[model samples]
Target chain A: MNSITTPSYAVHFNQIAYTELNKHLSQSKYSKIFILVDENTHNYCLPTFLAQINEDYDFEIIEIEEGEVNKNIHTCTQVWEVLSELDADRKSAMINLGGGVVTDLGGFVASCFKRGIDFINVPTTLLSMVDASVGGKTGVDLGPLKNQIGVINQPQMVLIVPEFLKTLNERQLQSGFAEMLKHGLIRDAAYWESLKAVLDFENIADFIYTSVTIKNEVVLQDPTEQNLRKILNYGHTLGHAIESYFLESPKHDLLLHGEAISIGMILEGYLSFKLTGLPESELNDIKASFLARYKKTTFTKTDIDTILTLLKFDKKNSHGNVNFVLLKNIGECAIDIKVPEDLLKEAFEFYAE
Target chain B: MNSITTPSYAVHFNQIAYTELNKHLSQSKYSKIFILVDENTHNYCLPTFLAQINEDYDFEIIEIEEGEVNKNIHTCTQVWEVLSELDADRKSAMINLGGGVVTDLGGFVASCFKRGIDFINVPTTLLSMVDASVGGKTGVDLGPLKNQIGVINQPQMVLIVPEFLKTLNERQLQSGFAEMLKHGLIRDAAYWESLKAVLDFENIADFIYTSVTIKNEVVLQDPTEQNLRKILNYGHTLGHAIESYFLESPKHDLLLHGEAISIGMILEGYLSFKLTGLPESELNDIKASFLARYKKTTFTKTDIDTILTLLKFDKKNSHGNVNFVLLKNIGECAIDIKVPEDLLKEAFEFYAE
Candidate 1:
């Protein structure tokens, strides 16, 4: 594919990404380069990424422990202190070479270190490539809440090398596939229909490219999430709460982000049928498509109640009201739709069915 | 005298500030209004500020401890939690009603909360009114390093009510005055001469206005502190190191920001005379002026050595070189000037004189 242009930066793919990154590095006189990574990326992805650098440059690998649990302010504090200890000055550049947790936290670290510094995002996960690659939303989870403490800071460039997808487990691939499915659901019916079939892991690059293009177009219009950008949070309203609930609960098996959100899309699809005139047939299609791949987990009444309460803390909430983005149709989304609690319970029941 | 318009927001003065604030409050449909204060502002300033709120609105008072000690990410976390607990959504507006500590930290909190939110700076301290009001440099110090973590986020407006000056003690007032003096030294020599006379606290409002104007003009050109803005740090390089050293050292008496920077101006002035064509006569004049107001603190050889080491950590530093903004003349400034360690030692000796 070709390079994707954002409002401020570019998203380069495969060989082009390496070329652009090298060109950029040569032109910008960074005093030093700090590559942020997680333990997983350090072992699996870092060697390949480091090999792509064409020049003999000063590089520091600052690795954090992997996973969503590590993505918090404490981690940020440690990284910042490390940067300071390592003499990472204002002129130094940082390259975030991991998944969403690494990119988001690393971008925030770079943006905030000495007011702001230049950083590049080398997303190593399918999830990060499809979702985090386009948006300037860089932040860390606040306690159990997801992405609560963060800022909208764009990277200098984003490099999406699809070969890294091979590093991800089947669960991780499926998790990323959720966001790609979200792109189709929110804006492209034809794409949504195409995604209903089995995800072709062999041809994943094309899917990643399309997903990024969809996200890029939306964010380019509303980078700040003022209005149009809220559409991107289609399933995220309930999805995040579900993710947070499962993340916090010791009893439940950790659901991959995609698995939880897959359930969110089904519940939200049901809400759309009742509230926004989404056809019952389309909603069923949405449910069947996700259910075919993701295992259906039973939510106890307490779980349902807790998740509903958690909705109030959603970043999308305003005026003490939990807002949802429901599909008017598969290709179209209606933002800021205040879904009633009783109807939400009904949507959950629909998910169970 | 008149509203100083920034690139994005306006700085409303005294009575006009209240009017603009009230007008703004009435116009924007904020979910809630959060007033961030410290213990001092809560006791001294909030009563008067609350009275100015002509209309009854949902208000939450989020107080952090007063002083620079409390300005850190830990305090930010507390405030962020409180904002979340208080349901401070994206539509909610925050009014930062304290000194530089409150305004800088609160602006950072409001900006990073839920990505970003609208905030107003109600600068109660002269330091905040003149320096923190216009720059859009919102941050908290990391360990002893000042402003190590933050972003350049502008407020919706800045309200400078000089009456708030009455709430500050002599030390607080003096601390703010140092920054005002900085404005004159960096940009307006005549203003510097005028400020050398004993500060008439009754007429302090005029000084604040002029200082803000000088700062506003500079920030309007380069809000990001890329190049020209470094001149604002004319005295801050050594000043910050001196402040940090005192702040962290248990043996030393706590120096007000102004007191430390006052010394910094004298030392840097000597360096300027030696390295940047600043007249020795003017350098002596700068030292004499500060000595007349501020008591000379003894910095032992160890203290001097530690402060010099801290210079490497300054935000202005890039490419492993500690950069300084020196005075070319009384009103003129030179940026990115490199000073050697031997000359720096000599400059400290000049201060001892």
Candidate 2:
């Protein structure tokens, strides 16, 4: 167990069990309700998933063309016009039954419609249920930038039954699992050690539950991501750069979020070992554990250099310093730690081969 | 005193001295605050106003071309982009010091930028301080339609400093004063009588305070205009139709809000007389009092006919039967009362000569 007790929610993550869903969907008068889904969830996740929902509602499913590239103000305005034509009154609610992009976009639409209405989150992705749902942040990307325009408003509640994870390919599942692992590594060493035995889909449920608990506690401490919440950005600092770098490249689908973060953690662990004098054993253990689980993708010196350049544009660099969250130990984190140019170059070489 | 209680806020008018404004201005943290004015206020009202507000704020004045014709999505967006580039942050507060249109549009634009920021209302026109600011119903009209898209958020607090009425032209002051009289005719008889003596700017400060108090109480009872609040829509049933019709005409300056509503009250009061056998004396008192105070405009048969045609679009007309708020006496109101088409035409002709 970790000694760090920070304020956060006690988020529960499980399969979207039928009996579990039926319990909460009692009908009320609605002007008109809508379910927003993205292309992926529309095909892969929504059909059997909606069958599990208990009651009937006067609602239609609104689907947008898939992918993060479509998450912009134009898409949001289209959704708003549709809702307006549908005669969505104050009594209406939107069920965002997809991943983070769907919920984030849906929540933004609902917040600005006739000056805001209600929305419920049904996060289908592992990254979404544990992280996005617990935070009240909702927004859309501006042009090519990330989350440039948004608002902070909490959902009525988030339904985190995680059975939707079944449809995800192995790569997708592993991508999500990386965030779960980082939660344990940054907050609870015992939980980190406990995870060594079970890192695959077969045991993703219990691990998801524990990871959510750790994240909820972090959020409860600082919901705004002001101070301690920066710790959650540990692997994400570099992980996002790597994800952004690979997203524009020819190697896009070879990895998902968890896969990218797993790589980020490996390189960051190497950085930890080199600069912080983290015990060599712990460093190797973290690397070998992720290597054993996540499928490795090869990147050249140029890819790392491109990623390093992109890191400077990160949204969190408010004061223009590239800050990293480095692990002092398995259960400890120190933020705003900058690494040297040569050290970063050397860490990327650890995976170059 | 009229036997009817003033319904919580029906005390007669009273002035708030310049010292009161100085005291209230000291409480806000703003280093430099601004008073937004239009061509009308700039020419007719600013000299006395600037003299009074001296030393309270490092005030900056901005003027826009006035009139309801200027209220459009383009203006709102322009105002937003300007406010954003001006470096107005969370700490800065805008004092919307104007009539209904300025308060409505200014409050709406300020509410949406940077997601939202704080603002206060110092309503110069009676229509705003009494109804718009008190209920926090801030939004601009979309195109020719009224508040077709908007939000409901409260101002920091509405300062009911009515001395600003002193500079309003006789017609402009009466344009606002008509709504105050409607408040009494619909909700408080004592208030209606109180206005008979104090409708002029000489006694308007006290009356403005009472009008604000009455409106503030009614709004608090039902802030969203969901149920109990709809009672406040007494004269507004046909009033808005007459207002909208006049708005589209080249002769808009010939008809202000009070003139349209005075005509509406007379017409709607005639409907009450028809339905409830409200004494002819009360009906005549309604016509005589509005005529006694207002320079009643002569509406031709075609003008009256067009206004009646437009009444069908009033938001309160749920099934399009033209629901009316009728006065049983000076203070008593009956909601959801429907009037016959022929009777409405007859009421319009009641003052045709």
Candidate 3:
């Protein structure tokens, strides 16, 4: 409640995680409260969340239909119209209890409502709790593009209760794990080795903490993603294009955030091997590990070609060059590495192995 | 062309007026450039704007269709799509050139694109150059309602070239003049009277400086509009509802911003007489003078009833209470004055004179 306490938000994570809903929420300083749940969260997560929170305080429920496709300006307007209808005033606070789709878009909706209102994030999916919830970057994505439009606004607090991750499917977990792996690879060799053993969800708490810690520390310094933070985007360059490309095809399964990112890491890793002197055998070791864990989704040469086209248009590509975050060995990354067009196909081929 | 050393931007009557714009903008030092313009501005204002700028910089022009009806999340999406297409990067700067509609919506789009690229605002319309442009408030209006979604982001610099006023019709100029009057009523007394004679389109440099001076001082003290600065909403409390109601009707031409505020001033002035014992003669004089300059649009009892009903849903009003900004005196205003529904009706009747 004391927002000025300078985001000692870490101290409250456990309190947020384990405390009985009634004991803490009844004492919450918010005058009026609401929960923002996307369609998926409304169906899958809100019922449980509703059960836990005490009914002592006045509360409202706002639900938006879920999915990455809905993360557009039109959806944001619908959410705003609902907020306006509900008489959401400055004193009102929203608890966004959903995945990255809801958390990111809902945070942006709340941020723009009357020049902003305080909101708390309870990221439901592993993708959101560990990744999207930490950075305070919130907005719906532009059409077919990932995070094309948004604002940077930190929430009052992010309530990370991993109990919600139990609802995430196996594909979702694998997808989320990719970013956890990415966080470690970009900055911490020791953290990477420790996480390399996190094969199942049983030991997720440690992985989440480490991943969020890496993200939080980077955000604390750069906040704006000017220099050091760009390293956090290690695998997302081609990963996003691949994700968007797949989303366009009706036959393709919806890839979770981590799944797309996992492929991104492997592709970027291959580029790293070719451009930087990352040993070919070590690259194989990295590819084998992900390939063994994630069932390979074969992309036709044409699918990859479409993705490559999008990569050229990526926001990361400064000055019209396809800039990449390439790995130096396994633990390091160098920003702004330009990779040629044909080599992209070679990297994907290398990643397939 | 040194931006920082650009000569003072102000309207001088018998006083000096100054505000810093380049000071904050120079810190950004962008690489590429972008300008957002509405259809009206693309034709009327952009030529003059391009002429004034340094010819060396390459720029991209993004134009949106005009009208308050297009101001929404959809419009923002189109603008984002354009920015993304142009390969706008972190170093890209956007110039929002047009009216309140353009400044507010353009500012929001720039703030969200790539999680906020730096943007400067060049307000061509009077309402924006003085009111919407200065507050760092940016977002689109919702449907027939007023500003329903928005963010607070100061532009790198707000370029106020009164030359754009030449393109404004009398109705548009009257719309913008309301804020100038509100600025005077809330902050300075002598400046308000001088404006009755000094409002010459030919000699507007001094007037622009005067308006910007009061706004800049208030914004400098409270960049976020937390306290004393809100007094600038004196007439706007009911004026906006009146404006929204009229805008939704077929008779929008009859009711402009200054005209609506003139009515709001009369009604609130009557409320002020009841609430703060403001001399009745001063209230009469105020109403007469504003009416002398601003042609009045007659609202039937039913129209007043509809506006009052709409007022119940205003973002500024809470708990089903109308929060009227009442004048304590000629140059003083107070916020959060809860008036009885009956007294509000009575206040309207008092203005029937």
TM-score of each: 0.99, 0.69, 0.92
Q: Candidate 1 residues A1-353, lDDT tens each?
A: 89999979999999999999999999998999999999999999999988988999999999999999999999999999999988889889999999999999999999899989999999998899999998899999888889888899889999999999989888888889999899999999998888777556777788789999999999989877878898888888899999999999999999888888999999999999999999999998999899888889999999999999899999888899888899999899998788888999999999998
Please write out the lDDT profile of model 1 over residues B98-187, one tens digit for every residue: 988999999999888988999999999888888889988899999988899999999999999999888878877888888888888999
lDDT of 2 at A174: 66
Could you tell me the lDDT of residue A30 within candidate 1?
96
Ranking of candidates on TM-score, top first: 1, 3, 2
Candidate 2 positional error at B99, Å:
4.2
TM-score of candidate 1 against the unseen true structure? 0.99
Over all chains combined, what TM-score does candidate 3 have? 0.92
Best candidate according to lDDT: 1
User: For all candidates listed, what's the TM-score of chain B alone?
Assistant: 0.98, 0.84, 0.88
lDDT of 1 at A154: 87
Indicate which candidate wins on DockQ: 1
**Model 3 C-alpha lDDT per residue in residues B1-353, reported as the tens digit of each score:** 11211122322111110123333334555656888898889999888766645334667999988877778777887888888877887678888888877888888888888778877777887788677656677887776567777888867666666778899987788777777877777777787777766555566656666677777777777766677677777877788789888878885554666678778888888898898777888788778878777776667888889998778666666555677778877777777788888888887887775
Angstrom error at residue A220, model 1: 1.4
DockQ of 3: 0.59
Model 2, A67-113: lDDT tens digits are 67777766876786676555565567788888778988888777756
Q: After superposition, how far is residue A154 of candidate 1 from its true place, in Å?
A: 1.0
Instruction: List ranges where model 2 is wrong by over 4 Å.
Output: A1-27, A38-46, A49-57, A60-77, A140-151, A166-203, A211-353, B1-115, B140-145, B160-171, B197-199, B224-226, B235-329, B333-353
lDDT of 3 by residue, A195-278 (tens): 777768965875787677778888788877777778888889988898888877787888766788888888888889889777
Best by TM-score: 1
What Cα-based lDDT does every candidate model obtain?
A: 0.91, 0.69, 0.75
Q: Is candidate 1 or 3 superior in DockQ?
A: 1
